[model samples]
Target: MPISQDRPFEIIVLGPPVSGKGTQAKLLAKTFDIPHVSTGQILHSIKDDIANPLAQKVAEFINAGSLVPDELVNQLVADRIKKDDCVNGFILDGYPRTLSQAQAIDTAVKLDYVFLVNVSDETIIERISGRRVCKNGHVWHIKYSPPKTETVCDDCGEPLFLRDDDKSAVVKNRLEIFHQNMAPIIEFYERAGILIRIDGEKHIEEVFQQFVRHMIYDLRNKVNRSSGGSPSGTATI
Candidate 1:
């Protein structure tokens, strides 16, 4: 089906930590020519902006590798989606971690689809526990660790350190807590019939391509039907 340019489409990308939601959302937004709105990235971008209290709080939590309270995060998301760039369409990542947050989002804006990237707990731990980052903002995973320099950043020669949340014990606890909070939200979306599940254990490029195909196919079908036209029943290239 062909996507009409007349109406906007909004999508929400949800997943556990280290599930690659960020990468997939960015790719889908580029493919569909829409803005990618990451609540985390948005908060990070305005970390130093003093005018917004929520931004300040979010920056503090993010810098410490902790999650922000749902109420504050919801407000930040609502504020971001009201911007001009999101008028046409938007892809959301890293928001709505709880059922309340999802309900808050429904009140703030209309969502057309929810893409859920599912990865095993073992895979998430393997991906996150081996992670390291430098003060200069470079990141590396021990399984795919940086060069022989070891503790030094290959690009800047600065020291690299393990993030507090990436420590083995912390990662385990975080994943457990995440699943506890996420189950309800997953059930909510499932009941809505707009949830599209994708396996996140695949190669990054393959996962990204699959996400793009799903978004294009779904959005085009919605547009076609909105115009009172029949579906083309063809996959997007």
Candidate 2:
């Protein structure tokens, strides 16, 4: 099916830490010729912008090592989606961490799809535990993308060390917290029938191919039917 120029595609990617949601979202945005709007990236960029009042408000909380309030996050997202770049469509990542945040966005826009990149807890642990970082902030995975020299960064030639957060215990703890926080939000989307689950344990390219196939299938079905149902299924591609 062809992408309609009449309506915008609003997509949201949700996943646990290290589940590759950000990468997948980026791919979707690029393929569809839309912007990848990542809240984490937005927050990081806003910290340095002293001119915008909202940026100043966001910076204060970030500098104080405090979580940005749901209201503020919703406002930021609402404002972001209103930008001219988002007129065609946008892929959203790293926002709506809570039920309130999700509901707030619900009022602002109707989403076409909400994809959850599902990976097993064991897979997440292995993926994160294998990560190593250099002092210069270069990242490498021991199993997937190993450095040219063991424990040495390819770019900086510095010794790579395991980040404290990458330890097995910490990864497990983060997974637990992620599930606890995301449960309600997931349920909300599931009820709305717009939630599609993708198996994230596959290789990166294969995972992206799954996304492409699913999008084509869903859009084609919607074009065929008078009232297309929610595309809810695990990606098999």
Candidate 3:
């Protein structure tokens, strides 16, 4: 576990809705020059490939508004990480929701860090509720991210509408389901001693910097311990 350059920085960033999991994951993936792999987006891309039968199957479940089965998801995930880009490591978002997938992922690769971004349920509700979007793809928030004009897209003059998923009842239900399903996955990583909890309620910049600092400190400590206090603590690009 000295994390030689031969191995990539495999990371998993997870959290409840509005916890900024994807946002932070993307930034870190860029910083590390690795792919930001999102299973949800992967499923979407697969759904668009009509000629591929397995991809079509993934599409069928999604088109029916049903949850994709874990077996298929696991297969897709396993296949995804084997691609060349992932050889340099990848930041994962929205995968391994269940213990089975978590175990499957472990068998496939050694994850460097499993970061869980935590935010209060109340803050999640507020963050989701304030989000608004227009048909033109412009998004805004009511409080901290308001548009230049009230309730209207500054570019298109289109009225912004709240997403159904952002409704209080919907968000609450989603959070409940997420935590219930993610409990075992979280426990799995914790038992492995690679899980790191992060505060997701902080400003985006603050959260990103805090995670980077913690990552560097812990990684350096691991390297030094494994190298018997040598210069392995200093990582090179």
Candidate 4:
């Protein structure tokens, strides 16, 4: 069925940690002038709003540096998507980590697209292991965000240190856990026929441009088909 252009469309981005989902979602949301709702950020922002038993349990898990169960996460996402800002449309990131969560989301909102930024496990480890942060709030990637001078912030002249969590061993463990949880979710989106895979190993700007183009194309096709016109692949924005 063709999508209704009169109503706002929701976009769901699925990817492992450090696969640039957050960055890409932010860019797409900015270009489309929509809200970028990240579940992790949302939970962090509302950490003090625990009024119910479920919220208390979620808080406990978060405080323990563990992931919240899928059910609670889905409920949080569903609640957030009903807000006024999301009425116009929004990008969802870091939710739907399991097939059950995906089914719950299907009941809550219509996902126009499910974008998967595909990157190898090795690449992800390499990309995240070199991340460094400075005391002055500057971030640098050893391979990608390198400073002009080694181990020093180019802007603030502060010493740059690797985050303990960004170490290779920790990152590898995280990746393994993510794959174990995410494989079925990916399959769910695939069966839904809305999955769009994009190569994430490319430069950040290149990936952003490709995503924008795909969005425009998909929106245009949806609109055209809804109006009883022959579907054309061309899109203009």
TM-score of 1: 0.76
Instruction: Write down the worst ten-residue block by lDDT for model 3.
Output: 1-10
Q: Estimate each model's TM-score.
A: 0.76, 0.87, 0.85, 0.82
Per-residue error (Å), model 1, residue 88: 1.7
Largest TM-score belongs to which candidate? 2
* Cα lDDT tens digits for candidate 2, 110-220: 888898999999999989999989999999998889998778999999999999988999988988899999999999999999888898988899989877887887776
The residue pairs found clashing in candidate 2 are none
lDDT of 1 by residue, 51-91 (tens): 87776777788889987778888878777877777767788
Q: Which stretches of candidate 3 lie over 4 Å from their true place?
A: 1-6, 50-53, 133-137, 147-161, 230-237
Q: What TM-score number comes out for model 3?
A: 0.85
Stronger candidate by lDDT (1 vs 3): 3
Per-residue error for 204 in candidate 3, Å, reads 1.3
Where's the lowest-lDDT run of ten residues in candidate 1?
A: 1-10
Better lDDT candidate (3, 4): 3
lDDT of each: 0.80, 0.86, 0.84, 0.81
- Per-candidate clashes come to 0, 0, 0, 0
